[model samples]
Target chain A: MKLVVHMGVLLGVGLGLGLADMALRPLAESAENATDINDLIGQTDPDSGTPANTEPDVDTPEIRDPVDDGTGNTEPVDDGTSDNTEPVVDTPPDVPVVTSEPEFPRTTPGPNWPAHHVTVEQASQLFGRPDVLFVDARALDKFEEGHVQGAICLPLEAFHGQQPQILEFHTSMDFPIVVIYCGGGDCEESDAVRDLLMPDGYENVYVMHDGWPGWVKMGLPGETGQGEFEGFYDW
Target chain B: MGDKDSCSAGCGMTRWIALPVRVALGGVFVFAAFNKLFITNGPALFNKSIHAFKLDEYGMTEGMMTLSTHLVPWVELVAGLALILGFWLRAAATITGAMLVVFIAMYASVLLRDLNVECGCFGKLSPFCPKTVGSCHILQNATMLLMAGLLAWWGRSAISVDGMLAGKAKAPADAA
Candidate 1:
């Protein structure tokens, strides 16, 4: 009886303390303003106190500017803000916003183009189509290094925390056809993000089967270094 | 009576030595649990780390993982506090020791799989973190296990509530 009483007291204290901590935590990092991968397991550089970039050790010349359309649409520039907020992508007036799925030619069920899988060709076809939005499910550093041109960085690890912003961003795009991808073959992050998006009323979602490496291997137009991407907004 | 006095003196010295070990084991658990339970998105992060162990391959479901993520911290917290107070020292030490065993096994599994993910045992307080579950984490758990095992072997200490109770019970028996 004495043991039981002591155990009960300890249990009560633990539960009480746990609840108090969660409830009284600062609201500075709520769902809407939650950061990307850096907030989720990203290590801080002990010397700088800033998140250290965890990008793969593949060095390539940084693309100096965004792909200029010659329509006076200048490149998207990062504000270089200390908060690490992703630079907002300016939607040009000419960019088409599709509210529904579109009819595309070539519907072959190849190994790379299975149902729910978009081949590199298929992804390229959808690229800049205004109806398709590519979502990069890799870490922020990797996403910054190189991604499908115009791809939005919403890493799989931080998906739950950044779900609100993802949903809001898609809603702004009128819920375009979202093609999600990560590092490449065997990287299940894209599939995981797709699973998450489906429950939230996001239809027309497809996992890019080729992934980022697939795009790079195929020599498809790619952007390196913080192109037009939505970053974590630390408010 | 001389033998009893000498034995008592030895036991008293042992208790003093065991006190710090008990306190250390208890303090570690308390700190670990406090971070896991209280930090922002602590439970969710812990849940992710648990899943990274690939328990699903061993037939553990997402629901069970989620339950464990929440349950483990409270168990650690209660057991830790009990050990610190020296109330139910045996039970507390046994529980903590068992937990360490499980932790050691999980980290060993991580090593076998060559996974590169944080242990997340102390939430954000993993000061020695390679930020990955590796040999260091296993060694840490082993150290804790040793402490808990020693506490269990020593039973109660002289500076404890349990010891006071034992003394009161013995006094009544002597008077009778």
Candidate 2:
């Protein structure tokens, strides 16, 4: 009957496509930190399967607490600031140091969560830094409404078409610090974009954890309408 | 030429309306299924989207959710194609209608809970996609459900392959 023929073709196409998807998927390269947030924080190194202990155990210089260096001082003597007189050394080229002024107060003491998280103050400081690039992962309209002052728009919905361009551009730049964000805590687009990039060995990437809403909430500067540098984070 | 009863004005109107509805419904299914079938990481993303729905909260296992994710797209593709072709019109309409009901329920649950996530209906295609379902998503699905119901009620169309085949079969019977 005509019924049998039509059903046959329909099922054939659907099953054929589905089976092809299952079979071919394994051949593709897998992501190093796909769907794993802890990986972003350096809690578990992908290759080692153990906690990456990066803390240094060297002795730090003593603080120069001023209590009138005790020689029956009538007037306080001026100390030219600091206990250590040793000149600061420049960071080696091989090391990827994420340095910033201590602008934000920290109540908790520990290693910063790698480059995965950036506080509002830290993100603000990162502005205008030649090595830092802001990535907006929300839709183009949302990007047009408002975003970080110099952020690149890369909406997850259009990832398929725009992904190649990002991969190529970032690769050429040798992977600068990419500070990515979406609408905010409620939006998962930022995380999705980060996951997409991680497989290709982009390690310097950081998530603007608070997201764009958080930036707005903090009263940070933002730009409205289309950016001159849309899609790619040229700076 | 003497078959006026079989081609009444009411019947003509029903067939004309059914033709567009069937084709449109079929096209939507094909388009939706094509993206789900071919897009890179489509299956994985779909599985994640289903998990977002908190089906696990409803006592569904990970394995069951995984199977549904794999199977649903193919069924939609097949049913949609069948309806468009007007081959086994009644059967195809019934299947499509049932699937629409399931989709409506799923979208309704998402709306009720107020979860913010992609609908995954069109596999990242924008404009057509109701990103993070609200009233819009429910309305879209409801419209599709009505179309499916109408297709089922009409059951046949003069412009379909089903109609042509029936006419050919009747010719042989008449000659005999």
Best by TM-score: 2
Put down candidate 1 lDDT per residue, A137-162, tens digits, no spaces: 88878887778888877777665555
lDDT of 2 by residue, A124-208 (tens): 5566777667888887777888888877786776556555576566556653567788764335787788776553445456666
Candidate 2's error at B167, in angstroms?
Answer: 2.0
Global lDDT of each candidate? 0.63, 0.61
Error of 1 at B151 (Å): 1.0
Best by DockQ: 2
Clashing pairs in 2: none
Assign candidate 2 its CAPRI class. incorrect
Give the docking tier of candidate 1.
Answer: incorrect
What's the residue-level lDDT of A230 in candidate 2? Answer: 56
* Residue A82's lDDT in candidate 2: 14
Model 1 deviation from native, Cα RMSD in Å? 16.5
Q: TM-score for every candidate vs. truth?
A: 0.50, 0.50
